[model samples]
Target: MTGSPAIPEASAASALVFVGPMAAGKTSIGRRVARELGWEFHDTDARIVAGHGPITEIFAEHGEAHFRALEEEAVRSALTGGAGRIVSLGGGAVLSSATRQLLRGFPVVLLTTTQEAVLSRTNLDKRPLLKDDPEAWGRIYAERLPLYREVADQTWASERRPKEHIAAEITAWFRANHAPAEPIHGEAKDEQHD
Candidate 1:
């Protein structure tokens, strides 16, 4: 991904976290919301790529267990950065209890898309889990849906809507329910370009 402007500390710290199943438009919508809010957008998956190389490579080299550890670390760093940014997490990021706890008090939105939509948006070959069994993708989604619902403060279904529309919905939700709060732990600064 190309670099974007660094988000203000205030915006970064109060970030809206997006979580959901694969191809649910989390990353795309998150980016739109961040752009609309004039805040920074960061994807934990992207950070993982920046830190440990591509996800496929990580899984191939050290296996999923190692990759998950890296994902957890990336999530922790994004949370602790204290920027009111918009963070798009990997589909399985919420599988970790630690990650869920870390998201407490943040505006967490879950993007829900249909199975058909998911299958259409994702590449079967690139996804490690989906490559094996014909039913693996469906199985994984069914298993993870409950967990996603459990952690989400708000949920948005994005079956056929444009990403911008979904992002507008998120922004509307934020305007209505979000209460601006002072930075927790106060780690504000203009860092180098993201």
Candidate 2:
């Protein structure tokens, strides 16, 4: 029997990538989804921290540009890694055009939260950008919203919902839309025609 076209083995169809502003629960929710799906989970921010050091230290000592470069490297690594993964990107990871271009090959999900929700969930001490001015979160999110939209294949509003429920929704959507392709049964190479 004939079968539909096969997806590239290394394409984004093999992974679910989450992107959004700080406190949007990308890491937490992504972990849950990956666990439920029995897939690997990759958090680019965590990769940066493990490889370099704390992000705050990176910003304080090296500055945002340096941190962004490191972030892009981490993003590239996660996206290019073999599939069956849920990858969570830092809020600012989308700022790089190169990173955004890399994301175009994958299934990207945007997790969003209201200002009130984010303010309530945020630990300003850890966020270098919002440490001195928490209100800056609004302005920053506004500026980056377009970029987030540009890369996202699906937008999930994560405000005021239990992470389990949100993860379930994403999981269901992923399974439904990105189910593995069936093997082709037609045209066996070894068959001898009469």
Candidate 3:
């Protein structure tokens, strides 16, 4: 055991993952948390968009199943990188059983907001699923609540509060609970200054 490399006390899935309905501010809040923690940040939806195209076009041309497949791959790539960071999943990412399974053992947070809040918060025209049927988001949220709760280690309401506050609270919880005794890989970047 002499001169052996130090083993990580935490798992590869130790990164904090954010999940919830659309317009729940997961990306913004997760970015803030990453900045505060000095860790990397990845938004799975953005990954998908970058690799393929706009989500609306993907849904229209290839359909939901195809898009979900791409989304699953994005989730996998983000979490399996063996780094402690913040990852914001697509709103419908939890609907994939593979994604849900991969989320196990990871620090997952669910950001919940009312349908009214979501409607008033963002543009629906860009949301493919909600463009023609904005009310469908409520039903989708209801249907997915159980899955969200299943993977979420904690839940935070994004309603009537600044995203910075939510990110700070989540970051505090992460520091108190899941912060490694030391850095798992290397020094976390000072993302705030960058």
> Highest lDDT, which number?
3
Lowest lDDT 10-mer window, candidate 3?
Answer: 1-10
TM-score of each: 0.84, 0.87, 0.89
What residue runs in model 2 are displaced by over 4 Å at the alpha carbon?
1-10, 182-194
lDDT over C-alpha atoms for residue 174 of model 1? 85
Question: How well does candidate 1 match the true structure in TM-score terms?
Answer: 0.84
Q: Rank all candidate structures by their lDDT, best first, as comma-separated numbers.
A: 3, 2, 1
Model 3 misses residue 81 by how many Å? 1.8
lDDT of 3 at 123: 91
- Whole-model lDDT values for every prediction: 0.76, 0.82, 0.84
What lDDT would candidate 2 get against the real structure?
A: 0.82
Model 3's alpha-carbon lDDT is 0.84
Question: In model 2, where is the ten-residue run with the lowest total lDDT?
Answer: 184-193
- Superposed model 3: Cα runs more than 4 Å off: 1-13, 184-194
- What are the C-alpha RMSDs, in order, of all predicted structures? 6.7, 10.9, 6.2
Structure candidate 1, residue pairs in collision: 11-84, 12-83, 12-84, 12-85, 13-82, 13-83, 13-84, 14-84, 15-84
Per-residue lDDT over 110-146 for candidate 3, one digit per residue giving the tens place of the 0 to 100 score: 9999999988877998899999999999999999999
Give per-residue lDDT, candidate 1, residue 20. 92
RMSD of 3: 6.2
Residue 25 alpha-carbon offset, candidate 2, angstroms: 0.5
